[model samples]
Target chain A: MNYPNGSKQIPRSSQKLNSNETIFSNRGMTLEEDINATNDYYLDACLAVIHKKPTPVQIVKVDYPKRSAAVIKEGYFKQASTTDYNGVYRGKYVDFEAKETKNKTSFPLSNIHQHQVNHMKAVINQGGICFLIIRFAAFDETYLFQAHHLFEHWDNQFKGARKSIKYEQIRENGYFIPFAYQARVNYLSIVDQVYF
Target chain B: MNYPNGSKQIPRSSQKLNSNETIFSNRGMTLEEDINATNDYYLDACLAVIHKKPTPVQIVKVDYPKRSAAVIKEGYFKQASTTDYNGVYRGKYVDFEAKETKNKTSFPLSNIHQHQVNHMKAVINQGGICFLIIRFAAFDETYLFQAHHLFEHWDNQFKGARKSIKYEQIRENGYFIPFAYQARVNYLSIVDQVYF
Candidate 1:
């Protein structure tokens, strides 16, 4: 079936969900599916090459039921040491974490881990574009908040600053991702506006 | 304990295997370990931000015995669709696969999968740097062969060309990665020569 850009075939996993369905059920579509579809669109157009890192799993034991396939009998989820999505956009490194909140008023700082904040700092220090994609699921709005802005709030938290960032603050500092027909979450346009 | 790059502390996992051990047993050090150490050195020196993608696993069942932890009860390995290593180097996307051969005659083409070749092609098409790090273990020589050159050989195979690339062809076409005290496998230096 034809996808967003209609240039590349739909990914096997995302074949069941189409842009039309996503548009009709915007609230039902998870932020991840939207981003994944958007990434597929970007990839088809050769605009950027970004990918969400696979969830890390720590294996404890394995059983070799067959010579070719070894089954993991025991394992646990491991805390990721870096951001969810990262890649190159227009010959520049891009890194960011995607998160969503049901709360319409504020985004809780507790949703982000300390290590991830440190990782984004490292990426930014090394001259890479780093940011956070904050989605207010209740309002069906998503914003791209730069890492520097995120750091300012994160640093103040240790000095008794508010543990959550008000939605108004995000709206003020972040760029709104325009929802589009082909590109559901058109954040790269904002990346071009800010970074270019 | 000090690592090869004395600037950075030894990684927790590699603390047991110090530089001295790696140096003394160069033959014993797996290509994966060498590349990991090299990547760590690059990261510590702020030269590059590259990483090996985690082995993908397909989880079948999970048991949450505690509120804090979830144990995976059943899982299986999932074949990766891209190169093993990818990251940003000097604001450009870099993707590569590392392979080692005990064979003195030729590097076998069978070692690489078709999907990885396609992935590298896509990366290159999007203005990214993609290559292969082929190590002839017996000679302790590693070479950075660009994906284009690898592709030429790979494509010609179907037209009655050799199934494996000769060591002499690689020696002629690929840049040699100098062995170093700090970087262990100094492939980036060759990257500087070829790409920069």
Candidate 2:
């Protein structure tokens, strides 16, 4: 079926996670809402024009109450989006994906979708700035990894390499996004240093 | 209410046509979708990196079949969005709004939303490329009006000037984006000449 932006579902409903896969325990809110609020704060401060794309919810059913707000009652998880956040910066196009996990040792490969990885690679190939903002929420640390490096690791994984990307590997290959009061995730500073 | 980003909304609810209103008739497809397809052509040819943000729908109800997909059967129109298209080119961010009218003589100021106007101003202030692509479907003509000139006129219209911009005014204030076999709209060429 059709999803937002003509996204099609993957036929293979495959997963490495078992029936008892950790259900992504987190603080209080969904990782998406928190990152969205943070991005909103960043946008409000005029430190960056970045904004998170809407969650690609597959709207399967809805109830439009007369003179009331529409309430979503049923839906399915869509194919994870192609990009999490995108915006323009200093006249250049900037695009990225963001994810946070409570895992302490490494980020699980299952957290990312194949389509998103493909999209990030395409963005970089087309000469646009593309990266990812990865968070170790348990440690409260985040890093911005350029798309090229992500593709390298992702490709390696496809060839039967490590299933999880280690924290040390990220720290070595990724650019740490410096947190400022204004731009909470000031990925652009790193973008300037690396991609430009 | 949310729409992806830079996508416009047509208020099928409120439309008032005056004698001076410009008219543009198309093949019954959404201007947004058509432009999206056009942008895709541009992207494939390495001409531009633009996209239409998903149509923001405030879904109220959904239904999930046991083995089927979730369907959005009820929803309401979302608030008007900021712009119609935004992307990167040559390390620069490009942002713009697109509108089409059936009137041949003039385009109505009412076609634009206040928040979108504000967004264009902000983009300009932040040094991003901002503009409006006005298409007169009746005449099959489209022109790119820089946010600077549009803002000046839009602001003046609030005081006691033209409520609707004349076709001659658009010709004078805007640059024409040439249509091409590869790039269709070829908007980046205009961006290259004007913004870059």
Candidate 3:
């Protein structure tokens, strides 16, 4: 499909969509797609106003054609200083990052960055709800792990602890997010339970 | 200055800064630079956690060289579907759009998009503090116009009303944001007065 700007969509192998099936049943859908669909549902339902931030890019050069849109000729992605998703839910500020791991036993700390952890710490310090959405794709299980819980594990690694959070530990400490037809990754349910 | 990605900063005439003076006295600074500086101050002061969302880009092609980072070879900017700035303040959700106009008599409705208006309305409905930071560059004056006030002017344009809001009307309805040494566009003071 082509965007309004005349640029065609760059299809990713994991994001292939089948016309016959609903997004909720599209088992091959990546974690980002599910969360975006879920956020759209939440917006339409007036439950929340969350959105995935666009990828940050550093533009080096652009060419403005006579009558068409300006095209970026050179650009590079920048590391995001904040989380992937944030919004207001029930009059409360919410912020979170989502990650998908194929590893069967653990969610690696390498999936996150120190700057992101610092950002989340600042969010929590300001009284906002902050967390991570970790999806173990092999088991099709997604868990909502609060930021404070992740921080403890994050700091422990610097003290010679394991570099990843074990799946069993996540299962014990994080809330499991269930899939729904409308809200594919229904994380707000977990937010409602833990925050409110 | 060159970014970490090796992309040199594109010189914007209005954003040129002198090494001799602080940003507060940089009269030529655009509204965006002022707001960004203000946000940085707020972050360091532990007062707020707001950020301007990155410009959305529809990347069409990327080149991943052997040793360096991926380079976007072709891309087009996409219109954002939400307001520019958003974050948490005192545990409350805050969202806004910033626009600078050279018009002396009025602020044109065309400065904003319909989708942004819809997004702001949704945010207000969710009890988030939503507003517009309007700067009259000609007057060197800025005002924090609440989203609901903007909605009236926005909807009236479709009902055979003026296509722009009169300067006098904005002066009456919007809170004037005073410039400060640290907070160039000190809008949170208006938020504290109006919402808190």
Candidate 1's error at A150, in angstroms?
A: 1.2
lDDT (0-100) at residue A178 of candidate 1? 67
Number of the predicted model whose DockQ against the real structure is largest = 3
Best-to-worst order by lDDT is 3, 1, 2
TM-score, candidate 1, is 0.85
Q: Which of candidates 2 and 3 reaches a greater DockQ?
A: 3
lDDT per residue, candidate 1, B1-196, as tens digits?
A: 1122223432222346555564333578888999999999988888887888888899999998856699999999998878888777777778899999999899999999998887777788877888999988887777788899899989999999999999888877887666777787777877776787
Give lDDT per model, in order. 0.81, 0.67, 0.86
lDDT top scorer = 3
Can you tell me which runs of candidate 2 are displaced by over 4 Å? A1-31, A56-81, A178-189, A192-196, B1-30, B61-65, B72-74
lDDT of 1 at A123: 80
Number of backbone clashes in candidate 2: 32
Tens digit of lDDT per residue, candidate 3, span A31-93? 999999999999999999999999999999999999999999999999999998999998899
Off by over 4 Å in 1: A1-25, B1-25
Per-residue accuracy of model 2 over A1-196 as CA lDDT, tens digit each: 2111222311121224478766333246555665566567756656556666554555555667899876665554466436867876665678987889888889887877897886676567667788878888775566777788778778899799998889877877876555444445555666666755
